[model samples]
Target: MSGAVWDAGRCWRCEADDVPVIWLGPVQTQEHGAGPFAACEPCIRRLEQLVETHHMQADRSA
Candidate 1:
């Protein structure tokens, strides 16, 4: 995992390459054209947190 990929497999947030990369494919994976995605553990956590916070805010606003 540490040496997974040097270029595109980095953390989308912190630019880290010392952990396993997880794909963040589109929800509609069967679409005509799908792309690849990668994220490290910490970046994943941060992204999850932001999503949760955003959803909570949306709910409160509604």
Candidate 2:
């Protein structure tokens, strides 16, 4: 699906342009469920931060 074009106007987290939306595919886990939504650059960053926090918490617990 590389080089696929996404609908820029549907993106909510960032200004829609030529940039591809992040996390606009199926969810990685069953708990999260499936997703076809689009996210912008800042949202992607926020998601990364959230994942990092979760990982850190997991490590601390371990």
Candidate 3:
């Protein structure tokens, strides 16, 4: 999640509208309009946890 921002809009991850959102990276799916994808706080935290877990696994493997 690069260049993330806290805002109020639809969360691309959970599809929850009228809530707080953080704009992040590009929207890979064609279903979305343009880039600068939006995600809620919970989603961001989950993603951060996933990334941390992945890094830990990679470090152990290395």
Name the weakest run of 10 consecutive residues (lDDT summed) in model 1. 1-10
* Sort by lDDT, top down from the best: 3, 1, 2
C-alpha RMSD for every candidate: 6.7, 5.8, 3.3
Instruction: Please tell me which predicted candidate would have the highest TM-score against the true structure.
Output: 3
The backbone clash count of each candidate, in order, is: 0, 0, 0
Better of 1 and 3 by lDDT: 3
Error of 1 at 11 (Å): 1.9
In model 2, the clashing pairs are: none
lDDT per model vs. reference = 0.67, 0.65, 0.85
Residue 60's lDDT in candidate 2: 100
Per-residue CA lDDT of candidate 1, range 1-62, in tens? Answer: 34445344666557676666677654335656655667877777778899899999999999
Better of 2 and 3 by lDDT: 3
Q: Which candidate is the best by lDDT?
A: 3
Give the lDDT of residue 28 in candidate 3: 69
Q: Per-residue lDDT for 1-62 in model 2, tens only? A: 36645455445555566665654565445787665666766677787799899999999999
TM of each candidate vs. truth: 0.58, 0.53, 0.73
Ranking by TM-score: 3, 1, 2
Error of 3 at 22 (Å): 0.8
